[model samples]
Target: MASRLFKRPWTRSNDGSEATTASRPETPDDDDFHDAEEAVLHPDAHEEGGLAFNNRELLESQRSAIYELIRDMGMKFLTGHINLINMSLPVKMFEPRSYLEKLTDVWVYPALLTKAASCTDPVERMRWTVTWFVAGLQHVFQSWRKPFNPLLGETYQASQPDGSTVQMEQISHHPPISAFQITGPGYLFVGHSQPEVTFRANAIKTTAKGMRMLHFADGTSIDIVYPAYYMRGILSGTPRGEMVGTARFTDATHGLVCDVTFGKADGAAPSDRLLNRSDTCTATLCQLDRTNLASAQANSSASADASQERGWSKRLGGLTGRLTSLSLINRADNGLPEGSQVIGRGLGNWLSYFEWDHHRYWSIGESHATLWQPDPAALPSDCRFREDLVALRAGDVKQSQVLKEQLEVRQRQDAKLRKP
Candidate 1:
């Protein structure tokens, strides 16, 4: 039996509120709640590349805001490393034994900073960014007590004196300038350690102390010094330790404007053992700017042709040539010998000896042991030949005959004047 039952419809209040608002179970899927959370977490949720897409005006404003954020962040990250190294305690240690350990943790900052610059992952970037600044001061104590080997190659060996052999294995190709990045603004700290020595029979065995120069991103540089003396210790051990140098900032744009002097503690004292004290007066300017790579490439291509033309001009200008017979009769002062075989042996020697490219040396003997190194400074300055001098020195028969005829005219004038 079906029964008809009246059901009440949902009612709304007259206070202009949401009608029939469901008192649904509090679920996490509410649209208004989700939207509010998204707004709080990512305010630019609708933007692409951090720029608003709804309107041109909004996009312009977003772009400017984003750029400023990036610029401020980059500057802070870059300069933060410099400040951290400036205020470190291990850096203050003067003892040679503990120097290396003190600077061990210092490399973290630069390593992290370099990684941050290269990193693309946001998580890794954040980690490195934080690590870059927190890493404390770094002091690199270079031992002067250790023997330094100057590596030389075969080419260099052939040029140097006998018994002045260099240890080719020890030569390092790394430039000190690269370590500091002097091309940009930064600070550099250089440290010097005292010489350590050992007593050998009749000879004082000594190793020079080590010196290290630290370059910071900021312009400040610091230097530290350590004391080391070589004496027979209770045990036999090689004295190997580190030293520190001054700390100061240098402007990358202006470079070092003062003379930074470094010398041994004993003034002009010749000791194989390294000295302890040193001083610096900074004056030289170092600057780093963009190199014109394109212009340099262009110049390299035309350099060969330009060099050839210059060589031809120098050789031809030295040649002594005879004047045509027709001109000899017409012109009184032709400034040329009648007929002269240009003696260009000296010019040929000059050309043969001259090196267009000064980079390489010319082998002289068969074994090539003796090399004729070109000296551009030694080249003759008076390359142009005088016609009168050429006429007097002519050796060839045809050249002498032409010169005699020209000289006969001059002799006749002298004889006429003498007859009076």
Candidate 2:
């Protein structure tokens, strides 16, 4: 159905030759400047991507510093067995968020997909819906900090810009499960996810199992599932990760399904697998970087085939799938740059559409900083009420660690009381 529906429709002349179209350069209207103002320039253009000779050296040194961290990590992996929680890990590796906040990182982007959730056309909605899920692959190599596990019965809630709100609760401590539901005027989303944690010699693999069921105002429902994720270079090198599974979204009423493939198939040699080459982040970083760039192309036409794009729109076809292989969208099809024809029908700029930006590198930081209230609004039992969270966010690693262990101990005690 998608193959037939998403075929590029090209115009032809009387002679039957192919016709082409060009998008006018964006002309900003007064409302557009007032309206189109998305990112405020740092007041310096050259400072954006340009670099002086000395600055170039400094930047290279910075990357080299990060490169060294990878090498040192590899050396450490050569030592002893690292547990799933990495008890022996240097304190520097932990990013202070509770396990609950880390999972929220997974939910943030989906909330931005209200357009897809609210779409009336089932097919287009599925396309938008699944494409957005695949777009989550962008977070594959983000940061290496593993969040602390959430306590049983602990919960978190976030309201969306679309006037909708979603809540997640830690329903179990034994298997560590989180059940989330998004409710509002036009759509409803409910899902449960739990991870089976495993340790590879040089990496950590998380097999995430769950499905998010999206229901629309017209009774349309779509099931979205996320792919498995692995943290690479953890044991003996610079840590990174990538999305390595095939995710599917199936629409019940329409009998439609969209499958999105992310990351590369494992191609390590038998020896490479046994003796993890964690020293080099080269291969994984290369793949993740390319994936990231392609996703970035969706944000700016200048990064893509500019002649056809007129910026992302508010409609279904605006953000046409280009990066992650949209069985529903294409970039260069059959050796022909399907530029012009994909204009309005292409996948939208997911970043702008979902209002995601540089801060994604911070993951759940924005949610903790601005979205949730710490005092009166946050219950005494809320995670925001934890002093450890405050110390961690403030970069006080030692105090945060002390608080982390105390909280873990308390959780264990509470769990015992709940058992029959």
Candidate 3:
């Protein structure tokens, strides 16, 4: 049978940017968006009291199957935390792409990094880096479906329209680590992530753990730390994906550090949810003194949000000399001395553009360039060659499940043999 549901079509504006909801004209895609409500629980699908994640609302039979599997797992699931590193998920729960490809989503707007690299001012460069970081996060919560995990030794290679090249390798299996390096004009971004996922009651949390470094040709480098992700209401209510916690961007070369706090998902307002602004974030940049360094490194999501609630005004007056909103940044006179003063602040949602010092940096709707597309000349061991993924893409559910199981069994046996 043909698929029953079709969400929005990928539409673009005349400027090549993804069309914003504000400017998009009525089209068949609107009907698709409505049809999607039956399969996916989006913001508009909420009931009177709150939103819910009903298995009946899902696309295929696999959602109910997975729900049953989890329910049967029951008390076993109650055990402290269930790690998904070794888990073989149902193929239907995955998008037909591999985790390696997902990593490249960070470079959707290659221009952001190029702008950062070309900047002469270290603080301005840091601002651009933070903007790039914020802009790239829009993809993480686009849907609840997970990307297929990369098999050990798997590799993916692609390039950008801007002449940048990207390469990713599934370097390890037991702990499941993937490494990638992207080379662009005047900058090199290399990082390895071992994503850790834990299952909690009615929710799952994931953290991308590892080292990420961006080196510019001018010898200026940035050290990045990513935030935590949460997919809530998996069992019954509305299935929602949110990004929480704080991400740090530090430029040691200039003694400047930026702390970006992704606020909790705002479910109270339907309007905010519809526009992808339900999850908002704010960023503050300050000089890296020993005291400031200690404080920045010690921030958790709770503490970070608590600090903001306690009053950024007081903090801006003293040691942490930076405003927390774009409006305040705009009011600051540009003639002020550089050091020991508030440079600029940023405020925006994680799923769209943000304003820095009252200037809008990048918009998710405005990014129309295709930076990375799958290269046809992939190696034999590439994720594109995975039998299960191939089967799924071909719409052979049973064969996909069987192939997935076989692959998982082989992986387990190989891992056991490698153990001391």
Model 1, range 18-57, lDDT digits (tens) per residue?
2332432344765432111110111111111110123344
* Residue 212 lDDT in candidate 3: 70
Candidate 3 residue 7 C-alpha distance from true site, Å: 28
The Cα RMSD in angstroms, rounded to one decimal, for candidate 1 relative to the true structure is 37.9
All models, RMSD in angstroms: 37.9, 16.2, 12.4
Please provide, for model 2 over 208-240, each residue's C-alpha lDDT reduced to its tens digit, 9 standing for 90 to 100. 654456778887866565656665544332344
Highest TM-score against the true fold, candidate: 3
Error of 2 at 412 (Å): 2.3
| Model 3 lDDT tens row, 1-420 | 121221222334545566545466655645432112222222333232122234454534535755665787867675558887567777777777788887777568789899999999999899889888887765565445677888888889888888888878886786787877788999988767889888877777998876577889998878787888887766655676676777877665676767777663333234444223445677778775555444334443344356468563342233123222211111112221134345567766555446575455765445554658777897888888899889988989789889989988888898799889
TM-score, one value per model: 0.16, 0.55, 0.71
* Candidate 2 similarity to native, TM-score: 0.55
- In what order do the candidates fall by TM-score, top score first? 3, 2, 1
Residue ranges of candidate 1 with Cα displaced over 4 Å:
1-109, 112-150, 154-245, 254-420
| Candidate 3 global TM-score | 0.71
The CA root-mean-square deviation of candidate 3, after full C-alpha superposition on the true structure, stands at 12.4
Per-model lDDT: 0.24, 0.44, 0.65
